[model samples]
Target: MADPVSVDVPHKLGREAARARIAGGVGKLADMFPGGGTVEEHWEGDTLHFTLSAMGQKVASRLEVFEHHVHAEVDLPPMLTLFAGKIREKLAKEAPKLLE
Candidate 1:
């Protein structure tokens, strides 16, 4: 268990537009990893709750699409925590593209 990794990407798109763009790309979240994985996605109002399981690690994440930004919080396993900074950095860089 490790602390959650939080990343935010600012966007000019409003909530509806941002949400639509994010919804379309979220299905491919698993593909970003090497071995790929299954994602169980659930939505609660404006927030997306997703669990990614791959290579014996389960990463539970919450993503919220706001009017001005998208925010993500990933709960990584201990093994993955070592790379949390890198993961946060990458997410911050790529999330905005999804909104566009």
Candidate 2:
């Protein structure tokens, strides 16, 4: 938990709409990681709990859907903290396209 990297992806879709799109987009997330790693996802109310394991690292994340935006937080292990900024950037850049 090296200061969880988080990003807010703005969207016009309401909470429910955003949640639906996110739920459906979970599978595609694997593509974002090399080796198409394992991704386990579960929805808890308005938040999505995710765990991705790839290249000997485990990345946990949460996405909370709101009326105007979806907030994403990723917990990278110490070994991956060095790339936190890049991860945040990629998420910020790609989430909007996923929702659209």
Candidate 1 colliding pairs, count:
0
Instruction: Give the Å error, residue 68, model 1.
Output: 0.3
Candidate 1's error at 77, in angstroms? 1.2
- CA error at residue 97 for candidate 1, angstroms: 2.0
| Per-residue lDDT of candidate 1, residues 1-100 (tens digit) | 6779898888888999888887888877776543448888988999989988756788889889889988889888887877788788878776677776
C-alpha TM-scores of all predictions: 0.89, 0.92
Off by more than 4 A, model 2: 34-36
Measured with C-alpha atoms, the lDDT of residue 67 in candidate 1 is 90
> lDDT by residue for model 2 over 1-100, one digit each (tens)?
5799889999998999889898888877766654448889998999999999856888888999989999888888888888778777878877787698
TM-score, candidate 2, is 0.92
Instruction: Report, for every candidate in turn, its global Cα lDDT versus the true structure.
Output: 0.81, 0.83
